[model samples]
Target: MGIRYVSYRVVLLITKKLGLLKNKFPTKPKQSTFITLADWKDTKAKFLIESREKLNFPKTPNKKLKEETLRILNGEICFFSYDWKNIGLDYNWITNPDTNYEYDIHLHWTDIPDFKKENGDIKYVWEKSRFAFLLKIIRFDYHFEQDNSEFVFTQIESWIDKNPINQGPNWVCSQEISLRTFNWLYALYFYQNSNALTEERFQKIMYVIYWSLQHVYNHINFSRIAVRNNHAITETLFLAISQNLFPFFNESRKWSEIGTKYFEQEIDYQIYKDGTFLQFSMNYHRVVVQLLTFGIALKEIHNQKFSKVVYDKAYKSVQFLFECMQDENGFLPNYGANDGALFFPLNEYDFRNYKPQLNTLHKLLTNENLIVNDDVYDDENWFLSNIKFENNYVPLKRTYGIFSFDFGGYYLARKQNSFTFIRCGKHKDRPSHADNLHLDVWVKGENVLLDSGSYKYNTSEKNSNYFTGTSGHNTVSLNHASQMLKGSRFIWFYWSQAQKAMWQETENEYVFEGIISAFQYLNPKTIHKRKVTVSKNEELWNVVDEVSFANTDSMQQNWHYNSDKIQFHTIELQNDIESYNSSYYGLKEKGEGISFSFNKNITTQIKYVEE
Candidate 1:
């Protein structure tokens, strides 16, 4: 049988078995069951496509975090921490849901505080690990006092036993926060020995460990789902493997088989062949690095040999991480608000060292070349390639036919001295940017046709005109319609691919051409041709689209360019529009190729590293 048929059948079988095809991708996840208490409002989410959109100072906000950690340590949050059991519960009933799911409810980041209002304004957000890590510091600062032991147990029990809790739902078995609870319960049972054991606690501990292993470490469907990368998914994978905690859960033979099953397929979802993970956020990339460290430590502790696939993938993935790291305004672009606690001191240590992006890790290297130490940062791309239309996707069968093209743009070093990039794609997608096939080049660091990035997610009403829709990007705006697939879910999902992205050299100029399929409704035989040329002599670039939508009407197209700085350009439209942009930062021009310019001298060179 042909590899395509065989490979396709494999995916088809898996999806069929999982029943995933039957389930429509949710516009928003049902959080009442998984995350919080209620559905969010348009007041909160501010789905921005309505506005052309109008559009951060951070210097290791770590010092303030350290101070708070110290306060929690001194027992300040709970006045006089003498066995919190005595204190009547001020906060109770996380929720008393009518629906039922039996929950042991071991809290993972329970140490952190929830959303709080201060001085008539919402200030500190209740993020998962950041606040939780601080709480652990507070507890440690007290030196594990004997008097406070009751307080910890009572509070943890009350907190954990709440009606609603968060852990991926694999409801076939009992619904318990099995992973974190295992650690919590294990820590207490073996506090004296600092190791979880004893014949009595063994079986129960095994059950929890079994659940953790099944979710991320198993071959079944339970492992496929993910939140942000820092949702502690990677940490869950490593906790079992690195702790040599396997025997306590399952036997040696069974453990090895299951362990191999967990990673080989699952890792593909995280690390692309180019070494990038699906989630584009930088903080998550950092999380992946730490996970790799734990994975290595795991192999040694368990004395098990990982498959060559896992070893080879991890090594190559590090290369991808280093390539994506850059010096934006000094820190990685805050693509989206990321809230995770530092595994170490942030001011003094570079988190990148945890899985340092050097060509190879050395025995002699002491500290890491911090994300801060790296001279480049890209506000444009949060991760390597946010959402990819890639072929040559995997499996040796069709590697030759495999092609990877991104609507999301990339950062390139021109002549190895300056940085220029193209920004396409959004971890969140929109229908109204001119940046569909838009190429924004910053030859030697100048704001050329660029991506007009988002304004705000929290405060929507006013900023809407500036951040949402076609005018925010650099693509050709056909009518007021967007080039993207619309609706809120479109912001998060895609259904098609870009084909024939051939990169070639014509002695002095660089050439790239591909066909972008809007990923619309998956009707067969639909194609849109896009071509981009960057000339060495012109020191200029031109992008053209001969896009033909097959049997579809009123489709919109746009190109977007995002940057820290805004560009001043007049929209000299040759084609007339029904109406101009209703909001700011958008255009209403409808037609074929449109040229928007930035009067500046720049250089964009395209060269490839020999594989």
Candidate 2:
């Protein structure tokens, strides 16, 4: 219907010109510090403004919105989102709450931050001591120095308490990290099942802060992409509209001045000016440093104001989340941290931020006077400061004109990952084990070629087909099971309709590369050809493909490497026949996505002027 009302009003005018709505922030009292609260009673805030005026939903009004935007751009649907799945990909099943979760065995213990560290960074000290042992064994009710004084709970909890009172996606958050980790661990087990009362734990913490603002304002603010989505879940949804949806009611100064002007324009346009969080990641800067250490411990237990430009922009976003860590192995760099969820120190390698309340903050991404042992990372004045945290930053790439099989773009740009992006995208009538324009390197910020993530989809889907192909991606592949899009690709519709990228960076000495195309269903008369070489004697980085297809002939150039951490060092061919030296396999994830392969026809070799 007029291209789905011009693609849902061009994605709400690019999320209202990218400030992504907090109603668009900046109310001033000297640009805010939030404390003003003069009075606020506790009447249970009409259990969330009468459940946000009974949210009737169905707003296709304006004359039934051009026949409901041609029944949602011809993919017709109505009543409560049709068979949904566009990007929600089940969105991590509310913390994968055991549908009888199975496993024969996979153990490798010792981690309370590596029992006390030796050389750290074995993947952030085994996932920050296995997420502090899955939040001390499924959150709340604790005690066990080898067993004693009872207080139990935890079967691997925290998908915001298996999120549901309004369907799931982990029941999205807000209201200050849904009152400290998923509706205060389910309203502190409904105030210890009503026994520990202070008015029954403040009326089950105002019914879990009015059911987390009717499940994040009925999902309109689950932040589909607004208010930069997760800055410690929008500061625990503005600490649940300032400590339990504003002192639990009595009209509460006209809905707490319209939810404090939509959380002061969603923390100044979802935070920036150097608070760094345009969606970049260091495991989401530890959820924006525990949501600014729980709003600095709820402004010391009850003075909640939050201004000083939101406490110096959440203390320069915890010093840009420890200066976006990277030194080959100081750890952290995965750009988008997305593996199975339930994070309670399963082990990434003795996670270290260095104590003494993170020593006022100067992290530079760990090394705080040594401890980790195995992967060996000692700091000895490693602080190296001039303030240039190796910024190559890169985000302004935005072009997307073609790719669902019609060649590529007139030119290209195809940027990737802005914070934690990786729906693992795809296309071609709708293909997707994911590989459109195929990108995966990051450089200096670390990540040499990754994407080989997903493992067990069914016998680990053929060893995760080298991270779903085009030879695991840095672009150009004419063989090795082809692949650009087909089955399993998340629905994009437009996140740049599946690949057509372009890049440049060179004064000379060869650093530039190209992709300008990717996306095909049928259309090939000759080969496809590809190249990305760099090895002036082991600098290591190569891939070249040349295919020919009028009637297929002689072509076999497979160069796959699965182990030995990658050490081939050399290989070149112009026209040959027999070739064998296999070593390719995938599915060793923590943050998967690593690929490299060049085997097909042949006709791509360039040095041009300064090799």
Candidate 3:
């Protein structure tokens, strides 16, 4: 290994060691403190004991937005569809809700009279039911829509009775607890004026929030990673929200103080200087945006203000969200870990469309409108309702040009009818996928070549590896091996480094040239180079791959692409290349791919004729 490679290894090892030893977060609590509330006399936590008035969710002002929200509320059996397969939820059981919760969650979605489970895994069902609590709150608050207050309270009562303090699947993860606590608090506020919210019921709900907060307090360390990414932000946002909204307890003050500090710290740390998320996954980036937007909205409604740095990073983050969209309908390049997590699924758009979030963030920060085609998006109604509205400001500007984010390792060449996004950078933070030098190409708003999204986090080991491997991306792979060495399911032993080595353009044609070290999983002396040239009209494109190695015999190089939007048999290939691709997670489709055997160089040309 060269001195540079050795230095990289040493840095990573030292980083891991420091992460393991870091312990600034709260220590795990004992059973005795599981349900305990802070003492009022504790001056250190005095702010938590102050009174907090409830805030209202935004009422629909735009007719189009209102109708959509009402349609979803009335038409669907469930307010939100948790399953992407369009499966119906079995409110009686948590499993698939449509089918059943996972075997381990040990809890049901609804309050079944005889729900029994010998073993429970809390992480399985808690994430699904997270919005369930908020849905109940909405149902009761909009009484004209539907008053399921009794059912909602019964479900809460059953959940409290079934899942004891710090026991079973529900209490297993502090992050889940933190999320649930935030939702439960909102539900309480939404239903505060309802007859169903009795004094006894209110206390029970408060007790649940208190207990959940305690769990989060005990396990805060789990959220505080060396990178301090979204997990840590979620925990801190929950703490800050809890402090501001549920200031009935004595601990709220300390939580507010510390949580706000960490919130700002994470905003500064987890968000890159270029406004990209540190995780480098578009979906996780969206999650961070949602968390930041929600935190900022909550504080704004309560008259709590973060520093200008927090607000500025948030605005730039939203700007990045807008810039990263690859299509007209707002579909982002599914270039990273995607768990089908939509923080607020108020709108019925596909998970890939990020406009809802982008518009929401725009409205929150600027106090101006973005003139979205529709107003009643779930995110819009939810977030806009929290803050006061101002003059209409439309910022959705479309342009055909080149955009480069060096820090994020993304280069985009866009035209009125085409887009080419290239990924050619090494990770400054831990990478979630083995994709290096991946390219996402789109024509006429349809993706011609793309990244296969993460289907499931946990499945058969082979399937999980397939979706995350280098082969799943639109890139060249060596001997059917990933560019990086897989360590654990989500980690790579060594990261590949790729850079935009050259870029050239003429009136009718543009070229993007890049190179990546593919030696991590192959011969240490091998290097792979790629050059892509396309016409301004997007009618013709050429890709050239060159491999430099001391010994080329018996080495295999392959390139993959997607054919979902196009007929596979129609495309002309300059070389006798085979094809393979994937549509969803954990699944692969037979498509054309190029392969070279013991060759130093190969070139492929793709021509697009008018249909």
Candidate 4:
């Protein structure tokens, strides 16, 4: 390991030690009092006294959704084609759901299974089977246009009975708990007027929420440093929303205040000044936007507010997402780490269809129409029905050839119907993918060259490595190795640094060049420089890659393309060593593109024209 790697580990150790110390110092001392008989009786009697009032649902009645709601109620639940029940897990509700769960006796939390072991077979099942998302049943109420109080109550009660406090797989991560609490709160809000929300059921749900928040309060520091990405933001969002919306408990104000402070800071800290998220994943960026929407909505409801910086960051983040959006197809380029987390699946569109999220967040922020597909009623009905879409979308005016988001480290070259996105910058935080100078190209609405998005975070060791490797992206690789060395499953030891050397546009064409030497950490340093030229009038594009290395005979360079989309085009390669592309995760399709063997220098050219 290099000095940088060693220093990083040392800093990590120190931060973790400090986190441990902070854990011991609670914001307030825990209370010693227990629920007394009189208190229980009073709460029970108050809850039991039925008020003859109709529960107000968040969404207005839509008869068109009855069929879908009925299907969900009939157990035709959809979780990205993987249903929980089909995974063969028992539903006893009195014990740990994962039969193979092994609790860490000392830590008081169930240990996560090694995803690399068993060829990532166990984690594949467990990650999908974790019933945390089962709470999506609340969306059914939106469909039926009525509250399913009993259904929501039973689900929570059963979950609580099965997964004791900090003992099961669901209890392992405060992030998951926070998400569940948010969804549960949604259910309560939607079904507040239901008679099924009896005193007992309401109290039980409150107790569960209390337990979840307590776990978060105890482990906040861990989320602060180790998983300081979106996980920390989500936990704080839960604290803010819960403490603000459900303020009956004595700790609510404290929770709200702390949550708001951290959340506002994170908005500025995690999201860059130019609107790009630090995590570098488009999907994770959407998650942050979703949480922002939820948190902002709750704050509005509770008559609370965040600082102008938080709101400004949120607005810019939404605009970034809006710009990154693809043509009318609703699918943004699958760039960056994607773990298939469709947070708040309050819509019927495909998980990859980010239109719902973009539209929802845009409306939430500006109260002006961004892009409204009539088919996006589900997300709008649930989150932004109050906002009016008065303005119709006018086509975005083109601003000549090349546009670069300097702060985001992305360059967009557009000509008529073609667009290219080049990623070249040192990440602001931990990078989940080892892609440096990666390019994503699109023709009109189709993906011609794509960044085969991250498939799974934890599958087999080889797959986990391959999916995140530089070879999996449309970039240059040296010595058949990634641009940077892998530090762990989700980190690179030596982060690659990239800089734009040239960006010039002429009357007929646009030219862009970037230099990146991420492989300097290797013994004999190597550098790769790439230049892209696109003709404005012609439907043609070209790329040239030049490399400088000591042992050219031992080096390999490649240019990858989306094999699935390449079906519509013809590929010509000169001086290519080798080429292959995987259509999906864990499945590589060979002989799909060009790869090259180097001899001190190599030149490559590709022409893509619409058929």
Candidate with more favorable, higher lDDT: 1 or 3: 3
Cα TM-score per model: 0.51, 0.28, 0.79, 0.82
Candidate lDDT (C-alpha), each: 0.35, 0.32, 0.61, 0.62
Over the stretch 272-362, how does candidate 4's per-residue lDDT look in tens digits?
A: 9888888888888888988887776556544567787877788778766666666557666678887666667766565767777777766
> How does residue 220 of candidate 4 score in lDDT?
72
Residue 521, model 4, lDDT: 69
Off by over 4 Å in 2: 5-134, 137-187, 190-197, 221-340, 343-562, 565-611
The candidate that wins on TM-score is 4
Q: Can you write out model 1's per-residue Cα lDDT over 531-605, one digit (the tens) per residue? A: 556565444455555545544443333433333232322333232222222111111222222233221111222
lDDT comparing candidate 3 with the true structure: 0.61
Q: Residue 273: error of model 1 in Å?
A: 2.5
List where candidate 3 sits over 4 angstroms from the true fold.
1-124, 136-144, 375-378, 389-396, 499-502, 550-598
Q: Which stretches of candidate 4 lie over 4 Å from their true place?
A: 1-85, 88-107, 110-136, 145-148, 385-401, 550-552, 563-591
Candidate order by lDDT, highest to lowest? Answer: 4, 3, 1, 2
Q: What is the lDDT of residue 288 in candidate 4?
A: 92
Name the runs in model 1 displaced over 4 angstroms. Answer: 1-65, 70-158, 161-220, 225-243, 250-256, 268-270, 278-286, 328-417, 422-494, 504-511, 519-546, 549-571, 574-611
RMSD, one per candidate, in order: 15.2, 23.5, 7.3, 5.7
Q: Give the range of the ten consecutive residues with the poorest summed lDDT in model 1.
A: 47-56
